[model samples]
Target: MEYITLNNGVKMPIVGTGTNTYGKVNNDYNGALTNEIPELESALELGYRSIDAAIMYRNEHLVGRVLAESTVPREELFITTKVPASEEYVSSKDATRAAIDNSLKNFQTDYLDLFLIHFPIENKEHLKNTWEVFEEYYEAGKLKAIGVSNFEKHHLDELKEFAKVKPAVNQIQINLKQPNKELLAICKEEGITPVAWGPMKAEDHQKEVLNEIGKAYNKTGAQVLLRYQIERGVVVIPKSHNPDNQRANLDLFDFELTTADVEKIENL
Candidate 1:
């Protein structure tokens, strides 16, 4: 695994596993769902040091359970979670306090490597109050770093004006189809690392674009896509239930892409 230093002076894994899921599945506090959902333990076994979960995902306890069984040490791994995407909690300091406490209990960890404001709220004032809680956690050493997710330039601009401590990261969607060029530029300028959520888009089965790229390097379409993002200096989290893909995603370090190959795929 590779590492990058955040503005706040903390090291994070450049490539990692992100446990970001959206659904209203019924499960116990430890995330034992009847549905055949992807298991977090498999990721741990495959050497994923970072786990991204959120209160909204409602699987923090389950994430904690997987970590507990893993051989990895707590300090060696980076864990991040997000607040509810609304002004309701941010407007009330009391609400923010309760939310953070709940998250800690759910994840079963004493400290968080990173925590982010899920997104800009409808009410601007609420954003200020929300950031206040994030700062508080940082000062207390409970949270090593803090950041924002799914924020555009306008959203980041507003936060930067009032942010006492700069954001360390901005998690967003980035893939072959969605390069998100403009937002990425702001992050590079503001000293925040951009972490991409969807690194692979199911192989683009319909498009010959992926197949063409795959042929050049003797790699699969999945490998080609992930390598493309890594070339752009973006941290990606590509999930898989199959063991083959789990191993394939980690096999990127062995090969490098040529300049022309990168340009051609970027056009696609």
Candidate 2:
């Protein structure tokens, strides 16, 4: 697996597994959750070193179980979880601190490689306060890198005004259709690495271009899509339950996309 350095100099796996695929807004972490754990296991077995989760996923316990039993050492794995945007936790600093503690307990790990504000609540003060707590954790070594997710340029600007530690990353929906050039440009200027979630879920029109490009490398459409993002210097987390898909997702480093091919996909 390849890696990209965050602003703080931590090496983050370029590709990882996301746990939101089992359906959001559900709490069946014991039954159906068991089915998804193997996909994470499969990812690890296939050499994926990063695993992304959130408190809202309600499956961190099961994720903890996997970590407890895996033969891999804790230091070799990168675990990330988030604080949700719901009012209950967002409105209270103590609640947010408890939420971080809960995630640590759920993951069965002492520290998280990265922690992010799951979503930007409209209230800038609340968001800034939450980030302040995250900054404290980061300084204390509970969190290695601090960041935000689903934030637009204006939200970042607002947070920056009172931010002592600038965010190291901005996780957002990035694909061919929504390349998010403006937001990405801002992150670049701010020294924040942009992580692309749903990197393979390209639009129908974009898929044609990806499929065409894949033929050159004897790869699949999804592989081409992921490669495109990586070439653009964005980290990606493409989720899959199938073992073959999980393995295939990481097979992006063997080829390169030309400037013309990249432009074709961009224009599509």
Candidate 3:
């Protein structure tokens, strides 16, 4: 798989599987937990090393169990999980610390490749305390990298006010529908990598455009969309339960989009 080096020099797989609904009944975000995640096993077998999970999904332990039981060594996996900005998890520094320790236990690993604040903590104190806990873990070698998700420019500016370590990534919605051009540019300016959460999302017309673009490369529209992001230094975590789609998501290194094609996409 291709990798993107963060500002802190940590290499993250450009293409990873998102586990928001994995191991849940009916694959629903609020569904009951199941005993196992066959899709995760398939992803691992198909060479997917990065796994994006979040505590809000309520299946960390299950996702972690699959990773722990997999044959892939801990070092080869680029595991990323998020901490929610809630009273239960981030009411205080000690609370945040407990949440992180629980996550490590759930993952069955001492270190995580990346950890992110799942959302923008509105309260300055909560945000500061949460970030400090994250920095503490990062300094302690427990978290390889720390970042934020769904952060706007103002939130980023707020983080910059006192952040000892700049955020390594800003995970946001980046697709044809929500191009998020300004945020992307800011990330580039700040040397923070952009990770696309819903990379495959596209309106019907946008999909048509992507389809037409894909025809030239003998790839699917989904492939073209993901390629567009990664070609411009955006990491994409496109989730799919189908084994074929999972394989297709990672089948991105073989082709390159021409400058004209990229321009056309940018225009779209």
In model 3, the Cα lDDT at residue 184 comes to: 92
Cα error, residue 76 of model 2, in Å, equals 1.1
TM-score between model 2 and native: 0.94
Model 1 lDDT per residue over 244-267, tens place = 777778777767888887887777
Error of model 2, residue 189, in angstroms? 1.3
Poorest lDDT segment (10 consecutive residues) of candidate 2: 22-31
Per-residue lDDT for 1-268 in model 2, tens only? Answer: 7889999999999888888754322323343543346677788889988888888877888777787689989999988888898888778788789888898888888899999999987887688778888988999999999899999998888898899998888999898767788998889888999999878877787788788888989999899889988988899999887889888999999999889988887787
lDDT of 2 at 96: 82
lDDT of each: 0.77, 0.85, 0.94
CA deviation > 4 Å runs, candidate 2 = 22-36
RMSD of 2: 2.4
List model 3 lDDT by residue over 1-268, tens digit each: 8888999999999999999989889998888989789999999999999999998988899899999999999999999999998888889999999989999999999999999999999999999999999999999999999999999999999999999999999999999889999989999999999999999898899889999999989999899989989999999999999999999999988999999999988888
Model 3: CA > 4 A from native = none
Per-candidate TM vs. native?
Answer: 0.89, 0.94, 0.98
Error of 1 at 105 (Å): 1.4
